[model samples]
Target: MTKPFDVKIGINPISWSNDDLPSLGGKTPLSVALAEGKAIGYQGFELGNKFPREPEALRAVLAGHGLELVSGWYSGRLARRSVEEEIEAVDTHLTLLAFNGAKVMVYGEVADSIQGTQEPLYKRPRFFHPEQWRDYADKLNAFAQHTLSRGVRVAYHHHMGAYVETPADVDRLMSLTSESVGLLFDSGHMTFAGGDAVAVLARHVGRVCHMHCKDVRPRVIRHARNRNWSFLESVINGAFTVPGDGSIDFRALIRLLYDNDYSGWLVVEAEQDPVVAPSYRYAEKGYRYLRDLVERVPLEAAREAA
Candidate 1:
């Protein structure tokens, strides 16, 4: 049975190789990653540090594997730098995305992020004072305009250690920026940040242009809190995983998106050590989990109609 709307499935290479901590899967070649990803039934892929930076070269590699370059991460330092500086930092990445015919660019503000570090994760990320919020939001609006001009959309990623990690942070950002700036809703991060993923989705579904289907282990999360683990430490302690293998109810989440007419890429973005949880196996598992969610109810409806 077909879904009522188009929702392509994609995966990130971080499942295979941690870009921040290269030691995780640094030895895993790009060729192997592309091959395994295609074999696991992913329709698209996000760019990783191992991927070729040149648009044409990257396109050729993806073309051979029958995959699309859906989107890639662009670190924006808008919290401290000028909008022009932010734009300049992302210009090359935006150009590559534009040239590759990708429509969305995931913008993660990394100026004060502790995502890659082993620092204590119990404290809240840096809070944006009112004046700083104004500046940051203004810059994001301008950056959205620039991306829109290039036939791409900027999807602000609310990540765990980044400044905009919590639900309130997301609300503040949405309120400050123009409607042109879209959101990249990640369910796992929301759960990790101690927020209701379903409610957050409901509140900001209109602004969401892309999605990341990540799941978390409650026990590891509890342990992380108890042990004062860092973001990377939590990941190392087995806090994250693909949809069904962990605690997130992806079915309920997808049903919400389905009912609300949500469409576009649903990316599997669980960053884990490849050795403990093999990449291809987890990729296949995540793919099946999402495939079931999208098809489960719709197929039953189709059968009843028949």
Candidate 2:
């Protein structure tokens, strides 16, 4: 069946192997991950810890499965470093992304981040001073321009424990940076951080370049907040899940993107224990949910035309 919408579905390798904790899917090979993702009808994949670093090698491996490189996460420190320094940190990755034909680079701020730390989630990083934001935005503008020079756009990822965790933080960052810097809209992280996923997308759809379609288990989220769990701890405790298995209303979200002419990679990214969730099963679940949504779009269009 053909899809009505023009979005390509991709999967993050974190489902097959947890990069932060390693032990979750440590034994699973990259080959296995690619095979399973392709088998489930994913046309692309995001880079993870076990992915090949060299462009040619990565390209050959992905081509073997008829998949493409969607994007890769680049940990940014523009909040505390010079523009030159932040660019240097992601130069190699940017080169690889360009060589492999990726358009968006996931820029996540990790300056003093408590993402993987055992500390409480309440201690997650945040930038407070106006002067600090001015300096960071200036650096981000230069860095985005540098990446644009190489034909790749920067999509800032608002991660759970990073500097841009809340909806207000996203608003501030969008306000500070120029339109060249796009937003990597992630539904799961926004919900996990207590932000309205739909509201954020509605407000920033024009500035969104890439998207992450992950859902959350509401009870687990409540548990995490009540127990003062860290970001990684909440992930370990089953706070996130594939779209159909969680509480988020993805039908509405997908329709919103479709109506707004949003087109690009819609990646399914849920960092879970591979043993508990079973990578292949969850990947297939997410793929089916998205495919079904796309199939129904034509009907919705017909209704609108009527």
Candidate 3:
């Protein structure tokens, strides 16, 4: 048997957040995920951005569920904000995350838009730009500095829309960043965005701070490419799933992580499926599948090595 990395399964709120949308209550789905996470034997969770912003209240909810806060999503246009302003926001969120023993901050870059037309659409990821890379790097450096100053770590999430998604993009990010600013790799999104996790992790092993253990459906990938599906839309359309249940080769992926000495958490990020699949049933099935995959991954490595 192969040794294991210190990993924890988590759910992204986007899936469960929409559960009690308008007519229904909103908190039900999220509560379900937290409860199910603990009941099914997960050690920690990445609380979604849409959770109640009040840190104390959020802490209470987490305590009730028996889940440790592993990490969380935050938004801002680092290009426009001053470092101090960003630090303030980081401090606030970090306090909540820290209170629950979270060590990593999942940074989501959102373009702040006013009701006015001058501000750009915040939800979409902007196209890649070299200058933007430096600005992003600078922003991350500043945030990482501030986070560390507060005694926490920050992982820059190169998510689908917010400017860092490709292999080259991840390259630029790691090259520009200090080790304090680490990679939060999402296997499903990497492959979905034309990135090979196997290759990318090989290049930046030392800088990977955290991970998301989700996987993608190849048929959905085919549909996504053929139909020009947006990343979020595809996620909403049942394109992502549990690790072994999807097309990703978790054995190779985990082997790479093991070789890299990845001692951080393996967050389970399935944004859209939680709603379509429902939190209780979806999380229960996902937990068992991922746990099994985690257990089997190392044996594959030992077999190959032998």
Top candidate on lDDT is 2
Q: Model 1 segments beyond 4 Å from truth?
A: 1-3, 300-306
Error of 1 at 234 (Å): 0.9
Question: Candidate 2 at 16: error in angstroms?
Answer: 0.6
Tens digits of lDDT, candidate 3, 177-266: 888887888888788778887888788878888888778878877786677655555665677776666778877777787766688787
TM-scores, one per candidate: 0.95, 0.97, 0.84
For each candidate in the order shown, give its overall lDDT on alpha carbons. 0.88, 0.90, 0.70
Model 1: weakest 10-residue lDDT segment is 119-128
lDDT of 1 by residue, 44-124 (tens): 899999989998999999999999998999988888888788778888899999999889999988887888788778564
Clashes of 1: 0
Q: How would you encode candidate 2's per-residue C-alpha lDDT over 71-139 as one tens digit per residue? A: 999988887888878888888999999999999999988889999898888888777899888888888
Task: Score candidate 3 by TM-score against the native.
Answer: 0.84
Ranking by TM-score: 2, 1, 3
RMSD to the hidden true structure, all candidates: 1.9, 1.7, 4.0
**Between which residue pairs do clashes occur in model 2?**
none
Which pairs, if any, clash in model 1? Answer: none
Q: List the candidates ranked by lDDT, beginning with the highest.
A: 2, 1, 3
